[model samples]
Target: MANPRNPNRLPSSSSSSSSSSRSVASPPLSSPPRITTSSRAAPPPPLPSAATPPLPPRLRPPRAAPPLPGLRGLRLRAPGGASLHRTARVFPSPSSYEFEIKEKGSHLLRLHFYPFVARGYDLSSASFHVSASGFTLLANFTTADPVLKEFVLWIDSDKLVLSFVPAQASSFAFVNAIEVVSAPKDLIGDVAIVPNQLEKFNGVSRQALETLYRINVGGPKVTPFNDTLWRTWVPDNELFVESDSTSKTLSFSGRIAYQKYGASREVAPDNVYSTARVVDGSDSNHNMTWVFPVSSGYKYLIRLHFCDIASLALNQLYFNIYVNGNSGYGDFDLSDAAGHVLASPYYIDFVADADNSGKVIVTIGPSKLSSPSWIHGLLNGVEVMKMNNSIGSLDGDASVVLVTENPVKRGFGEFVRSILCGFAFMSLLGIVFMLVMRLRAESGRTVLWSPLPTDVSGGKWGQGFPVASGKLEL
Candidate 1:
């Protein structure tokens, strides 16, 4: 190819020029190095919007550990280095689970199960000893030998918690433990018995004679038959005549006697020898009445004894006794009557209503007599006794005696009556005083005639006449 040489090329001739021109031939400068720029600075990168804040640096969270496997076996360690394992396996059953613990050390270790069964579990059959220090639990199961496949044990606060896994055989398999804590010392010390000091001589059987000797010759003074006064007397006397087989009418100082003469011995006697007497041959049917004044609210005892000396063939005898007017009667056989009989001078006890003011009367009659000719009678001793509620009858025949011993004046009704009487008396005196004053006022007299006013201005008649008024002439 032919090349155009520049004047600066100088010599070297056409041949060198021709070769150099071929090598130097190139395209012109390529349009001033072809300057290029990014498109509008990428539009200012679209200026971050308020809707989306830049995300924080990514953080990795901690991973959780795997759960522990379920418990399969249970065991306990004792202080003596002995270990006890549950030998009998407990299988989940329709009702309960059964298991056994092999005997371990001498010192019992307390095993507590929880979620305490509220009710309906037969804890009585379950063999376990719970002490103040601890407790042990045994499972009751149906299967001969089943394994306890799973269980959990941990201390939740003060309580020991245990939970069991459900068996595939049953939907509701439960295992529980009991919690045992030490008993308070205060509770342990409170268990003690206190004895009474005044209980001596309470059950002693008093002698019949001694009891009779204590009877009052006059009527009842205090509580009719107080404990110290008459209860012993009546019972002792009852013992005396209970075995007596005499056919003669036996009489004691008081109006107490057995009627041996009549076909049926009645307590109603034809004669009573006390100072206060009912006229002889009065109505025999009338209950022999006696009055022992007592405080209105005081309690008393009234006793009655019946004696009969006729025949023993009479099987049944009945008596009606009244206490404060209440009819209390019972029928008895010869033997029973004998049992009620007082020894020589014993007193039986009976109670009087504290509100009763009248005397107690005892009437004896045959409820059912085997023979009409059998002599049934009444032997007598009645006593009123005093006692507190706590000390009651000591023996079968011995009865508790409670007497009202307050004085007569203390009665509320009597007190009110006295006050009313005083007021009435005072009122009567006031009326009398008023009547006397009225009578005196009526008797005193004042002259009805009025004196003519003495002629202050005297009528004048010469020397003797008083002076008359200025215009008057005599």
Candidate 2:
């Protein structure tokens, strides 16, 4: 769908009053900045009195209709402290928000939705589909409260377009705010380790990802303001199962060594790497585990952050990492992983599938290769991002057919294979038919005389021949 023509608009999402409501202008064409805009509109001015003197045609104002009820803007706040949920812009038909891209890389797209009574329309009753850059981000999506949707897209084009289409003509579409920010170039890479597979999984940067969970192990919640990318990281106290009584939280007060080849500050804040959840050395046989609920039948990109702050010497701690009972990393030597430097940040990425129970369990247990007195395992932070299904959708099981390959290329390959198979089948049939015809002609070449030319005139051996009567004529 294209941008709506003369679409009805709402109040400004950034302001507190409707008087200042206006559409957010596009950023300059110099370079894409880490900022965004929203859709808004200003209410029409009141009509002048008849007693006033007649003014020029150009000076006279156009007639304005009375504003609809419930069109007034309402103030609200999201859990992340974003004030963009105060107002929204409603579209009676299909519409879009377009952006010009100056640099081509991965960009963060965040959408805020706050359903309410807008004018005479019930925003909660509205069902719509949202798509961006030819990927279906949402399908038949609706909500009662404020909701935020975030996605990371790989854009190698000059423009990024977002379209919103209502499910029905009677229904409407709306948005409170939209954010488009350039993410770090190294935020996402092209490769990951997959469980049970000997080969590495590549092309991870090509797929669109939806943020599922971001957790700071053994630490307090880190809000968006504290993160480099305005991301939120919640604590893992509730996620950690207390039944495993052999685990505890560990904190470091020293500076983290940020190596040139290791994780950077943009990858994770220092607060996340400073604290960790580690297994107590008392119970060497037990493991520290954290369970998370996820949608079944979908794969997730799991990133585990590690900083060896618990160990005092190099090559002292050896542990194993497991995902859903499968070995993700066996005999993981933290000291060796961080290049024999304690407090250096290092992370690992894995592609894991959600089981039937809709649970992804991560366990860190002591490795048999380590001494019994060594600390078993430790983790600093964890991030889980959901990968788009084969149908190219992040929401529901709705299949959206995407044109990823050129039709001409696929058709030519298929045509060549078909022609080769046809020739092979015809050649075999012709050989069998020729062999059958030759055998028939060879059998008919030989002939046998039915009755022997024996003498029957009684001059020679006429008695040896039998007559047509029952008795022989001897």
Candidate 3:
């Protein structure tokens, strides 16, 4: 019924004459059902191509790890979710395959292993060892539990050799995935290493340097997305050796430390700050040491990164830092020295000359005071920068201190070492030592590297590639 107040309403057509006309024009309600359906129903829709519903954007499996990028390995099932699943790689043999990277610099090496056992493999038989360019990255590594590893290495030559040796008991070893990202030339400082000129304190000229190692003292390897420079700072666990009980800790307390130095989450974007290594308070004499091998006669720069995440006073944690047994920093305190918890980080840098032994030793221990220091030894990050005295400094965000002191006096021992290195080892002893040095040589196995020209345009972020998981694994 139309409302009487509505002016737009149509006039009622219920007249005897109109009713008669409608009855004549329209069929009775009892007409056949088929005819009525044909008159009023819509056309059916076209059949669908697929049976199941489409996956949601997030649920869809991502593109699998870029076709080998040059290494050869079977693909494993990564159960860390589709994100990590697609990035998984597996090298079935106990021995490893080495890849050739044409360019050399400080590169971030990321190795991922999701501990989930696949169909045929037993997790218990998964122990193995890994090394890159003669430096052991992980030894006695196991998949008994899931783990993610990241490392920074200097690629000196045109090629990098990556080797994996599974334990005798374990039939095979594998890596779920790997990433080799190029890092900034100067890991800690913006300046470059240049040779000494006339004005320097000592007659010794600075040696050309490169980054042999960069470690995230207490943290996991940060991914490209989380890091502004996409730098990979390896966890110190592999190199960390406890002396009188030193321990590595991950502190939620220091999570926001980078912000204090005016860094936004995007810049200091990873969970690395919360992790740290500290000396054991219970031990009377605790120390933390890491050793690195290098070519003889080169000067190096070592940087120690620090941030106090513990809930103690500034002076509570105090220690001394040493390089090759020489005291570099006498008294180092984190909390007392660094007022902010998650603010920017603090670093101690030193220039060191590698002795004829071709090795550099870095150590941290309790202070020399007769009474024990308030806290314990601690470290957050470490960078071994190679100095290029000839080139001077470039732009990095680290501070470096050069010690132009008298070179450590060496006698006849130096002469003997130089001569001995040139001569070949005795046949029997050389073979024995070679086997003992598991990571020193590469076997006949060669990496496919790339059949075609290489493509590194992916840069730090893996541009043009959809391996979002790789970026997230920083």
Question: In TM-score terms, which candidate is top?
Answer: 2
Q: Which digits, one per residue and each the tens of the lDDT, describe model 3 over residues 291-360? A: 7666554467776766666534445666888877776767765554555443346665577777568777
Mind giving the per-residue lDDT tens digits that candidate 1 earns over 193-267? 111121222211111000112122212211111111001121122222222222222333443333233111111
- For candidate 1, the 10 contiguous residues with the lowest summed lDDT are 16-25
Off by over 4 Å in 3: 1-209, 259-270, 339-344, 368-374, 389-474
Residue 385 Cα positional deviation in candidate 1, in Å, after optimal superposition:
2.9
Between candidates 2 and 3, name the one with more favorable TM-score: 2
Q: Which ten residues in a row have the lowest lDDT in candidate 2?
A: 1-10
The TM-score that candidate 3 achieves is 0.39
Q: Total backbone clashes of model 3?
A: 33
Highest lDDT scorer: 2
lDDT score for residue 262 of model 2 = 87
Model 3 residue 346 CA deviation (Å) reads: 1.0
Per-candidate clash tally: 46, 0, 33
- On a 0 to 100 scale, what is the lDDT of residue 300 in model 2? 87
lDDT of 2 by residue, 392-459 (tens): 77877654432222234435656888899899889999999999999899867755433444665746
